[model samples]
Target: MAPVDRVDHNVLERTSLQTRLSEDTNTPEEQLKDIIQDLYQIMVQVSTYDSAGRSSREVLINEIKTLSESLRTLHTSASPPNNLPSVPPELLEYVEHGRNPDIYTREFVELVRRGNQLMRGKLNAFGTFRDILAENMTTAMPELRDDVVQVVEATGGVPPGRRNGEQSQSQPQQNGANSNHASSSAA
Candidate 1:
């Protein structure tokens, strides 16, 4: 099979696994929650054992047995496949500290955006400096005018008055003028 096809197959397999895992675990999670609530109610009943009579005590025992069976089923069904990705340690630590994981995600994204903005600012500053220096150099040394223009063009700088598609038609005229200027300076 082609490399691209293999990669696509892998992605589809992983997505299918994840979807199956989600569907398989959801019911067990709900059952586990209900079991915990049932246990809590049983605990309250047991705590009032004296007032709860023999019939009530038997009912509590039956409920406990039912909950125990449910927990066993949940334990078996909720076991995740070994191929599943483990949770990130940082996210676990955040949750352990009682912080919301979404807040951590937001802060991380904000930090990355700020870093990108700083880099963009630096790039813009350098580009501006390049254009300004090229313009000044071309104007100050007319004898080296062609060389300066070549350097500016090669470095992706649009010379002054040459922006917006104006450079193409005027470039030959500029080259002729530069040659005349160089010849005059040499004489």
Candidate 2:
């Protein structure tokens, strides 16, 4: 068979972009802004791919999952300093309720954008795994695959990793219902 040109144009572009971000960027903040934008796009693409029923884009899905996990880890590793700006309730309300706040900061926008990307990544990993499983199982048992897909969609996808029902039994329950009358009365 003659050699086929199976070139992925996006891969080349991504490599070039990474090189630029690392070497040509003027400051770390600029690099981070670019990364945040790319991550935002990735989360969007992952949603689009899943919605469009593109199960074959496993590599991209996995990359997004990994990037998301990494971002989460990095995000959680260090607590924000006490002096760092806190997200105001009004801004949060504006973002959550779709109200246009009169003023918003770039920092707030970036924080919210990163948070959204992380959430999508964390959630989509489970669905992507389910999709891969459903696709692989469909060839042999198409009907079962349909049922699997239906259940996954109906139940909003399965949680990842070893889900042990018995694990719940190991945890001892804390009974705080009958607290001291003083404590209860104080409330």
Identify the leading candidate in terms of lDDT: 1
Candidate 2 global CA lDDT score: 0.51
TM-score of each: 0.38, 0.24
Predicted structure 1: lDDT: 0.61
Task: Report the lDDT tens digits of candidate 1 across residue range 1-187.
Answer: 2222112323433353343335444577676776686576466546545553665565556556656655665777775876479777788999999999998889889989999999999887776676656656656765666787787788777654353335453465455445444533553
Candidate 1 global TM-score = 0.38
* RMSD (Å) per prediction: 19.2, 26.6
lDDT of each: 0.61, 0.51
Superposition TM-score, candidate 2 onto the true structure: 0.24
| Over 4 Å off, model 1 | 1-92, 164-187
CA error at residue 112 for candidate 1, angstroms: 1.3
